[model samples]
Target: MQRTAAPRQIAESLTELWSPRIIGELDDSYVKVAKVHGTLGWHSHDNEDELFFILKGQLRLEMAAETVTLSEGEMFVVPKGVQHNPVAEAECLILLIERKTTLHTGNVVTEHTRSLAEQLRSV
Candidate 1:
């Protein structure tokens, strides 16, 4: 079915924290939305770059070298193999663009790590 997805709507539908739900797909990539708070563990995707677009609240990206802050309407791309952690002091909504093969937590498996099967489920 052809339809339009609202990131905020998708995000609001999420019941789990830090869990991403697939909203759409584009070629080899999947478009996901998540409602996140607190911190996500540091990890790196060996072969896929991750794109993060903030749809609400604030986000802080902590990398090995520096930290980047993103507010609503901002976006950032973490290059492949770059280790980084994401933190949100308050509730934040984000849209993620990642390859279909990209792991939820990259090389590190944390309690928050989600399987592709989990992400693909209806929100």
Candidate 2:
């Protein structure tokens, strides 16, 4: 198996504002690191659940029913078919877990969704 340093650092070292790097992948699942700021569009995945782990800074997940804020070392799970939007006031690093076939924004295709596929890379 291939091993490397923590996924958190991989995000922190990135110079881009909203780019992601694939740290690892196992069968149907993958681990990715991203640097986020501002607000992401509301979207949902029809076939996959998503897990977000905060490695540094803070993030907020807003759903139709409620909004959850995550600090460093915290995590939250977004079930499949539930629409949610992710936001960050300041730059934050996050680790995302989801199935390989999972689309970034499900059926709500946007410019953001266009970058999702390219962001995925073999570890």
Candidate 3:
């Protein structure tokens, strides 16, 4: 059977902070939704790029070079090997598109890092 979902609806349904739940799969990547607040810390995916799409609210992506602010209906792609930290002032809903092998947190792992197994669980 093929699973169908509403990314925005599911994104809003999430209650955990920084914990991303897999909503679907595409080719070699996974589509995930997360409800975030505060910062996720600095990390870099050495080999894969990550896409951040705001479903609701806003986000600020901080990197060594610069910071990018994204509002609702906006998106950004953090290229491979760039260290970034995502921060949300209030509760925000976001959709992430990343390679299946991408770590929850790139090189740096903190208390908020979610393992692949954890993300793969049913939403």
Top lDDT hit: 1
Q: Rank the candidates by lDDT, best first.
A: 1, 3, 2
Residue pairs with backbone atoms closer than 3 Å in model 3 (clashes)? none
lDDT of 1 by residue, 1-123 (tens): 668668898898788999999989999999999999999989999999999999999999999988999999999999999999999999999999999999999979999999999998888
- Total clashes, candidate 3? 0
- RMSD (Å) of each candidate, 1 decimal: 0.9, 1.9, 1.1
Candidate 3 residue runs with Cα over 4 Å from true position: 1-3
Q: All candidates' lDDT scores?
A: 0.94, 0.84, 0.93
For all candidates, the clash counts are 0, 0, 0
lDDT of 3: 0.93
Q: Is candidate 1 or candidate 2 better by lDDT?
A: 1
Against the correct fold, how does model 1 do in TM-score?
Answer: 0.97
Candidate 3: RMSD to truth? 1.1
Predicted structure with the largest TM-score when compared to the true one: 1
TM-score of each candidate?
A: 0.97, 0.89, 0.95
lDDT of model 3, residue 9: 87
The best-first sequence of candidates by TM-score reads 1, 3, 2
lDDT of 3 by residue, 1-123 (tens): 676678888877877789999988899999999999999999999999999999999999999999999999999999999999999999899999999989999868799999999898777
